[model samples]
Target: MLYGAAYYHEYQPYERLEQDIDLMKEMNLTVVRLGESTWYSWEPEDGVFKLDWMDRVIDAMHAADIKVIFGTPTYAIPPWMAKKHPEVMAQHHSGTYVPYGYRQNMNHAHPAFRYYAERVIRKLISHYASHPAIIGYQIDNETSSGQLHNPDVFQKFLWYLKDKYKTVDNLNEVWGLTYWSHRINEWDELWKPDGNSTPGYDLDWRRFQSQLVTDLLDWEAQIVREYARPDQFITQCFVGAYSRPEANVFDISKSLDIVAINPYHVTQSGLELDPQNDTDTIGPEWMTSRQDHVGVSQIFLNGDWARGAKEQNFLITELNANSIGGSSTNYPGYEGQLRQAVYTFISKGANMVAYWHWHTLHYGFETYWGGVLGHSLEKGRIGREFEQIGAELIAHSDILTDLSTQADVGFLYHEDSKYALSYMPALSQPGTGNPDPLTYERVFDNFYRMYFNVNAQTAIVHPEQEFEKYPLLVVPALYAADDALLERLVAYAKNGGHLLLTFRSGYGDEFARARWAVAPGILRDAVGASYQEYSNLMKEVLVKGEGLDLPEGAAATAWADGLELESAEALATYQHPHFGQFPAIVTKVVGKGRVTYCGTLPNMPLGEALAAWTMNKAGIDPVIEGLPTTVRVTSTTATSGERLLFFTNWSWTPQTLPAIPGGGKDLLANVSISESDTLELGAWDVKIIVQAK
Candidate 1:
């Protein structure tokens, strides 16, 4: 379940490590990370530290028995520790502290940058913790480049808000800062929370920068568990909602052992960096410039940035086989974007399938070259279609490892109302002076873009818990419910649970202010619907409706726009160019839950056919149905009982799918099956089915 790659330090070419070990023994490639920017290819000297060229690349990948993972080469901090400690550098919270460049730039609360990153991870874990081709340690690479705004992390967020509000008048009453007169007297007259970008000082400085970049990857998983072997696995790299404060900025699942993700899924049909070149970085109209999707709608910011940091079995550790380099689009290269972003992260439950940079660099790091097999693999190579999808992920190895699947839809996601709606910036777009931030960041980007192109799977319950394991309880934009999460959403819709909410959701109360009334105001009698007037209307209109299948003049508009939803059985209306009509959608049944309220922001094909009619009235199962939207199906069952299934053919041409109703076998085309099989794949294909008892 840990198929790996990443290595890259001038693409090893020792006459092509025996053709990359015969193309990783035809894709059964167990593990091989070895990347810490290859520590300038083994100490380009300065108080030098070498360990004989990483013990001859871990004795040529343990004489091709491959296992090794090791990384912590102090994430490129070896310009002799920033030319001898330039205050350990890094800075940037808008103070722009660049001591040097590229590769993360240490200073994680400096103690001489954690003593040269724990002496380059205790010299690469005591020189390969007794090699046999080492088996763990990935600590740093894509560590913290944004989350945890600096001033050396606001002087350790003023001693962690004076040891979690024990003094400074309980951090001036939980940062209400005595309303404008602002008071602190002295925890050294604290500062942090800036840009009155309102909403309770931009949601406690975005929950203090999402718990300061997940406590800097929980202090690098407590220094890689004092140097590895707690059953050696340790993970770190994460991305998905790639931090505007939170989706993931280091939650190393309570200090590692496993939870690495790096998805870069980019497929909004045809591209040229569509959504009008949405630049924030990574891909598809990038985001994270302290986010503000104006009002949300870039297909709910690209399926909530690829279901931000996936969870289930958790472990992508970098997915995206190709076509990036400062995009001009050209399109789906590295085998059609690694067969649809690794079949949308192993059909959403990935066990482990690393990618990112297996070479490709020609002219000095070409601005983040989305790798696969370039530099060598030589002779007019087009990456033999990613070595034939890595020889079909090594023939679907044991149904794609550890599998576990279950999700009827939960979507509560409130990390303090996503940190007061990701720094309000006056909800950016009116000269960005910052104001509009009431954020649910487009309801956590439409529950991670309908759990990856409607294969449907969501979990994050928290509206004061107990919703009876999801019957469908989406509180998207639950702007801080309280009253015990609106009496646990009115006892999970009177013990029936199938609610849906939207619009500045319940109008804030947990101290972000505003709740005088309006908005599900105590969920308007558990969404029997009451809100009389709400038409903040700024126009970007288009609402179309008429028995939903949509696409024949199917438009729903208002990207960063807002509010609408009147009532009296009007599923949708308002086709405004300038506030002509209103009411976006409304439904009610209340007790035994079945409310619906969405006033705006529903366009990605009518918010994926209203999230496939609220996941077909909460029966749930969109994970992939009716093929092509770029195939993907993540379902798992391992711990030995075994029942794995992960088909991801992200599309570049070549698919077929639809058959796994039962009889299985494709474990990477080792082939066999029943329920009338029908796969095909190719382009960026990847399959792993097991099923049959």
Candidate 2:
């Protein structure tokens, strides 16, 4: 793996450029990302450019044998550009222009923003394209963070709708605008989609926003291609893959040569746990482990989503280097935590790992967001841990690079479903006193986490993608889907695929309208299940797994479908006095395969049991059996048929397990391990076993 960090030499408080280079070399940082957030430094005045300082930094990095991924400084606009062209600033939904103090505050659709962004990007790529030290270019830093929501963007959105719907009447009818007297009589009558009650309009508006960001990135990438060498790639560090409002990651990734992401985890005390819950009384150590599990699950989810965006191994452009300091309380990562984080991404198909920064700026908004070195510029605990990680990565780069995840399970995710369900949640959990509505994305993440916790190698699969490669497919909260996808699922199941679908799948069409047919819409026949009545679970409903072994008090939450079986057999039934006979989970044989429908949100124990059951039905085996729940295992196979097993312990408590089958060499430890021996993992430890071809 390529080990590196984002570096800002211009922001260095002292004259330690050479010293820092030596430190980076000592730590085995092979690459340094530069010039991303320095638009003002690059062009101090309008139409004037300065490149001397950046050149010096690049030369110094090259001298240390470190390559570079140069970034286009378009994410942050220069003060001069903002002052000269106030129209470039994005207007908020409240009809106010954003202030120029922050990065990503400009409207990408504005002509002024586009002109200057293109000029700066072209200039930077032209100047550095031939540099031997330059390996690639990062196009903008986290695009679409501040999405444009002004009159200009609104007009463009209207045009986009016109192109999509062709006529105003069609747009109005499709969005069901007549319900709220929101029908647009003329094209000009359509207004910005603020406070829009129509689901179709609101969902399409988000899609348009995603398109805007994708178009902006495509424009810059095309310009870069004109100047960059064939070996030089272009990528953008995507943030908020699952929950971002402005852009869809899958759409944006289509325009890049390689996918990249900036993923961060909350530190201790940062887990979104209900404070009044009993989890707080578990004591600090256990509580810390619980929170770390949550954080690590998010990292793994994001890494898998990044890889799924392009179906290729991606780079970790920015990862947590230190405790993030903003409005939140930040906790320093415990020792061995950094190494665990790095391996978490690597095991999931991350080709490169880069820390957010080389050094924490002495004076900035993120000054307390520590880096490899602190304000003293001396190596700290995290830095020392990173050094060890870097050395190991260097030692095993060849084997790691060719490694690709071998997963037999896939989790289907769709951005359109996420967008549609945001306005109208598919399931509603009550009695929690939390008024916030549950999102489909969160529900999907919960299911994904269940499989992940059990060390099941899983991939995020889009509905449009070729999902047949995985024998087992788990789809959760697919609130909005098209007929094609519904038919595809049925075909997949009929062809010997084991399909597991949770509550709210196929409830609505792509237009966000309820299906005219039976509940579950087009999937009723495929799943052999239909539900006409369902209710939110104000309290947990106990469910008894009839044939499958499950823990006591296994229950369903959020929502439960009053399912009436057509041709399916009940696998689990409700234990409630009034609903005792109703099936909570059912399965149906379709031709050579089977489909399982879960009527409600299965709690963790039930979810894990269901995952195990489904995997067995699909004839998929775990990478390593009997490993601790805290230890995550993922296996990858190289082109030469060499297999690699990555075991990451996500907890603070050390875990011991029997050596995995076919154990050959522990690449990280450089020691041979046999299947008969035992393997021990320290707190937040990682172990890699590579079996010869």
Candidate 3:
């Protein structure tokens, strides 16, 4: 388990490399990510390359026994490149070129921009590839920004569409361009996406934009691999669904070695484990935003998303350090809170945990984005907490590395659906007539938190992944899917896998076009139900009965589907004036398996009951039983044949639970405990127990 921060030796106001090294050693830091954010420091002038300065920092860190991870510095182009190649500046959807003074303002697909970025990536990797201190390379930081619409980029998109469709008529036919008199006579007659109202055209354009970003990172990976040694892996730090909905993490990560993510959440009351902590970001627009919640399921969702990137153990390239956000927002972790954050990441298969920075910045837009050491450049509470946690990580080293997390429930994360639903949202804000652009994530999170709050260890499964390993698969808002994918979902259910479907699923084709078949497109027969009409609610409407644990006060929120059962039975029904005539949930047995469709988004109580029903249908027990809501228990298996159970208390109040049913060694305390014993945990505590599988 490696621990440290993104050490920007060049960003310091003065010469304090020696002092930083002392502090890192004090915390038993094992890794340092260097040179990712500073493109100007790499090449100040157009043709000038000043690269030897990094050698001093890497050597010193190596002397202090810390591993190094180099970055390609392609995301932030130098100033000279911007001045020399202004054509590379990216244009937004409004037909306006983004001004300078901001990073990622250029088109990644532009030829001239690629030339300079390739040069720097080659220079950095080749110069430091031979050093034993280096263990990996990050091709880019965060990777994608808002979509690029440069003229050249659009021309490239035109070429892509032409190659895909072969003719303008084919393109028009596929995109349904006849609507609104949008039918094009010539390819050049097509309009920009700014004023376009066609869903199919907008969907294809968004997909092409994502392909450009994928090609950009894959190009960087190709260049870096030319110099990177076999021992050094390559990765891109992805800030998933939280930001940059345009960047397709699954396709981009295919060209790299492992998946890395930057999962940042709120501190203080945000981590309280309260059910009503309902604050959250507004989906892809959240670049610098943070979600406040009592249940820390978002981080787990982020981790599971990363794990699904390559379907393996992943790394935390960046995470929370202290009080994050602007100057006005200051809520750093309280006492043991920082330790809980670290362990939370580890519990979900983070091989390495690195903070955003080693020290706070003295001058920058993120000056208030605090770090391990604050602006005082002094040892503070964050440092004291990490010192102890860092030592504990070293003590539990062997089992922690390369541990694989397993879950019987697989939740599908479809980026195409997330993108398609964004343009054609199904839900709206509570009292507004406007659509909620984050409808997909809103629906996804509702189901994700439902299962998490019920203590079900759920795994994120992508569209291309094998689904047979999971006995139950919950698909939320599979709003966009092709015939092949929908057929596969039916086959999985027929083969004895419990399948749970949600609203907006199977409603559209791969092109985001509403299917001509009866609602739910191809999966209607398997689902045993279909809905032709749906409605959004301004407020909650009561829903009752059916689910085994359905409690009182359960209601349907947001959108509801008027589902009519064919060969299935009603599980739950809405208590609305008209919606009561239709079922809220329906289920049917197909072959050896069963299919359950949720026609409406359930509130917390109903969601938990539905989650429990899904578990019961799958015939699996909760990983942990009779534990406080504040305590999270999860299990991961090591490649060396051992089951490692992680117990985490998310609050300041201590907790006690029955020890897991086995005599196992507590990896954190280096003590042994037998079955039928009670386990004690302090405020904001974490424990890992290892036993024979």
| Tens digit per residue, CA lDDT, model 3, 175-242 | 89888788998989988877879888888888898898898888889988889899999999988444
Candidates in descending TM-score order = 3, 2, 1
In candidate 2, what are the lDDT values of residues 580-680, reduced to their tens digit? 75799999888889999998877777888888888888999887889876777878886678888888776666789776777688888889988788899
Q: Report backbone clashes per prediction.
A: 29, 0, 0
Which regions of candidate 2 deviate over 4 angstroms? 145-147, 268-293, 428-438
Model 3 segments more than 4 A misplaced: 275-295
Q: Every model's Cα RMSD, please?
A: 19.3, 3.1, 2.1
Every model's TM-score: 0.37, 0.95, 0.97
**Top-scoring candidate (lDDT):** 3
Candidate 1, poorest ten consecutive residues by summed lDDT: 294-303
The residue pairs in collision within model 2 are none
Superior by lDDT: candidate 2 or candidate 3: 3
* Model 3 global lDDT (CA atoms, 0 to 1): 0.84
